[model samples]
Target: MCVYLLRGIAFSKDDSIPKTGKAAIENKLLAEAVLESIIGKKGVSPGARLSLAERLSQLMKENKVEKDATKTDNQDEANDVSLGDKLAKEN
Candidate 1:
């Protein structure tokens, strides 16, 4: 699953975004390193290792798409009502 996802990212046609290409390469290398580390481990089962790889890949993809923290904080602030304001409104 991770392999297929990585392949899709790596082979994506749109090279207009440099960051996306860099992320794909970074993820691929990280995945390779992790797989190598787990290849001969005695304690972890194969299924567990594969699950970890899949989750890691998913997380990497999600991280790439995540919004900026400052933007999210601004949105939160816009949506939030102060406790004092809420109390005054209730009265």
Candidate 2:
């Protein structure tokens, strides 16, 4: 997930975070990086890793950052209806 780090933010399917040694984590990207770091580490407890997503979400809320913007209207619109359903309705 560190590979997907955008401007210091990184994420992955497993969830993790990156370390900012000697530096203050001030950017929203840090949340992503943090997730990446968690994914890279070994032997992380299930409860601890599960907390990562919630923690990142809290941080984003505190910073007034909206992640919903990552999704586009067009993308969701396409999924609004199944192809078979649409075709049946059209017929």
Candidate 3:
């Protein structure tokens, strides 16, 4: 599933990333590309790409770990990011 997700994201080597086997690294680069694609759309450097990738990877890991440790039975009944939050952030 992890590999499938990475493949779907298309961060594999020869894409927009340097030669690396780390999926999260690739995922981060892919994410940056999306962001740049929205705004500047310029290619980011290797260092920035790797750093962003690492940070994003850590965030994803933390989110998963938190979710796994959370109780399933009727918690807050709200997500971490709600529609209200999204609208507020957008504004």
Candidate 4:
């Protein structure tokens, strides 16, 4: 069942589980294409396509939130100074 759903999404590749930035970007593009393809593909139930699209949308939202949090953490770290640095600056 899982295999069928994945195939419906896109053609299987050895690097399906992307491990790098480029691969992740490619996978996302592929997913967008799949969503577009499914809408016109015949024989697929509307419910299935809607469910898949909704899940993808949800995942994208979650990913954005996580990225935002990471960016905020990085900004906070950048604005922080070590005690030694503070002391050196005051000296």
Candidate 5:
């Protein structure tokens, strides 16, 4: 039964990630580096690693865009309520 169960699962020829240390981590996307760190010490299928990296990259991009939008909105709000602008308008 155990043999049958193991046979049912597909394994990759090279499930491990290559490269390590700061050199391997540097000059790469944050998501890739982070996953590489995990796969270096632990085991992860190549397909699953790729999928996780894709999702993590997407989330990071979305978070950056959201932060930029919020910053611009806050600046606009500050300008709208500025004391100088209000006093100038009244004068």
Candidate 6:
């Protein structure tokens, strides 16, 4: 079921859609939502669902790491500007 959905998504990826950046992120979110829903449905064992949940958690963690890295880079740039201002004021 997941494979079929993935294949459909892959086939749908064409010139009509943006393939990188925000579009890519949106696609990933959609895929994750679909998988989560499937795993959350009836008939799946708790252990198997737990494994899927762990994978989802890891995925979210990776995304947070990327966002944190970007935020850190921005903060560094801001700090550099502030530091330069301090030095100028001391001069």
On lDDT, the candidate that comes out on top is 4
Work out candidate 6's RMSD over C-alphas: 10.6
Supply the global lDDT for candidate 4.
0.55
lDDT of each: 0.53, 0.54, 0.53, 0.55, 0.49, 0.51
Encode model 3's per-residue lDDT on 38-79: one tens digit a residue. 333254445444545675688899999999887466556544
- Candidate 2 per-residue lDDT, tens place, 1-91, comes to 3222333433345655554433446766776566555544652344445554566677779666565655557978756887889899999
- Backbone collision count in every prediction? 0, 15, 1, 0, 0, 0
**Model 6 worst lDDT window (10 residues):** 1-10
Which residue pairs show collisions in model 1?
A: none
Q: Which ten residues in a row have the lowest lDDT in candidate 2?
A: 1-10
Model 6 bad stretches (over 4 Å): 1-38, 72-91
RMSD of 5: 14.0
| Cα lDDT of model 5 by residue, 60-87, tens digit | 8999999877675466775677788789
TM-score of 5: 0.34
lDDT-better candidate, 3 vs 4: 4
Which runs in model 2 stand beyond 4 Å of their true positions? 1-43, 65-91
Global lDDT of model 3: 0.53
lDDT of 6 by residue, 1-91 (tens): 1112212222223324324332232476776675455455662445546644665688889999998776654656756667768899999
What's the C-alpha lDDT at position 69 in model 3? Answer: 84
Instruction: Give stretches of model 5 more than 4 Å off.
Output: 1-42, 72-91
lDDT of 3 at 50: 56
- TM-score of model 3 (CA atoms): 0.34
TM-score leader = 4
lDDT of 1: 0.53
